[model samples]
Target: MNLYQNDDTTIQIDALNMLKLKKNILLKGPTGSGKTKLAETLRHELDRPMHSINCSVDLDAESLLGFKTIEIKGGESVITFVEGPVIQAMKQGHLLYIDEINMAKPETLPILNGVLDFRRTITNPFTGEVITADDNFAVIAAINVGYVGTLPMNEALKNRFVVIDMDYISGETLKNVIRTQTLLEDETLIEQLGKFNKDLITMAEQGQISEEASSIRALLDLCDLTTIMPVERAVKRAIVDKLEDDREQQAIINAMELTF
Candidate 1:
């Protein structure tokens, strides 16, 4: 998917090009700022099969690496390998995407660092055998900044991969995305919504809410779902509610009434 447009912001160009030159990238951004989407786009550019591992507190060393298997159908299948997403990526030299890598357990961080750096190898815990990753194998991690309940990744680990900070797209850029993605008839209404979205984004930046005004993807959802429900209510639920608080919500309600 080409998540970014040719006329879109230039910041993405640097990261997109960097992915081609280097094997490791640490993408840092807010929740809905399109980091993951960009990673997907980069995968297409790299021409490698993509495998994403959603990292969480429960993900540890063994969960990232393969585990041993045993069976008794014919005879004991001791040390038979069952690959994790990382292991599979390594074996095939695909684009390995580690989502929310900072949220991974502390014990998992070191193993990841090893793979990103010169080690390029992991020792199977069960078999005590070391396997080197293919030279073409690459790593890309997307992480959320200022998220709660996430462990602070070790500095040494962070130093290995190049960090790229992604910010929100511009209002005009996002409006284009909304219009292109949605076959909406009322360009005026979309413009109104975009203005409201810009205001909401400013408020969110000031720490007034939990999320941005509304992401481009959210607007696309509004268009996709509007046919299934009332346009007003769909907009309210899909975009307005997430953009504002109770007081702001009531004001938005009054404002929306004027749109009709």
Candidate 2:
């Protein structure tokens, strides 16, 4: 929360400034691009309660907007309409962060159409309430392109936001994050890891490896594992072993051999 910038570097500042003016934005980028973290940073800066939702392919309007739950207030059970994260954020004027929004069901996305536009109200079919969004209520959805199992968001939804393209940072900026996150000042190791990550990403782009095997998370996990085991074993466990496809696994292993 105490994070500050002397030069206002990193794409995070761009997102903050854009959201300040537009109120809604779509953060579309590759995986491990820090989209979710950027959202959390903005949420803290705004000093608002955050309702985070990890969207799934199975998510529907009924589940996301609100749903009925049975409650026993008396001798008899009564159905109660409980608000979901979307409605809760709307009513309380909080930040509604939908992570990997493209994973959300197509039918579910229509429920948010009205809320994202000038007609900022969502109709709750269960309660028959047309809930108008609060002034402070904002939606920031993030999506990773070309990730397996992810579908393209409908044009209607894309029209609702000013798209912000986020991607991996580089040079000293990346090294700073590595030092801060890993708590290690080994420049040589950091540089090597950065090159390794870039190589992995290049492999993914060239259809030789899965992006899942080359995420920032995977690198951080590998770094953490190095403290307890050999780097080779750590690499296999943290990244290569995650790939289910034999060809993908072999390509990643071959790259590791060439790089290390």
Candidate 2 lDDT over residue span 1-260, tens digit each: 22323255545666677666646778887876667667877887789888888889778776677789999896899999989998999899898988898888776788788888888898898899989988888889999888788887888988888877867655566566677667446677778777877888888778788767767778778776766776778789999888889998888777777767
Candidate 1: count of backbone clashes, pairs at least 3 residues apart or interchain = 0
TM accuracy, model 1: 0.80
**Number of the predicted model whose TM-score against the real structure is largest:** 2
TM-score of each: 0.80, 0.87
lDDT of candidates 1 onward, in order: 0.70, 0.78
Please write out the lDDT profile of model 1 over residues 46-135, one tens digit for every residue.
678988888898887667786767766566555467788787888888888889988987766787666778788887665677777887
Clashes in model 1: which pairs?
Answer: none
**Which sections of candidate 2 miss by over 4 Å?**
1-10
Local lDDT at 206 for model 2 = 82
lDDT of 1 at 113: 62
Candidate 1 wrong stretches, greater than 4 Å: 1-9, 75-79, 179-186, 212-216, 236-260
| Clash count of each predicted structure | 0, 0
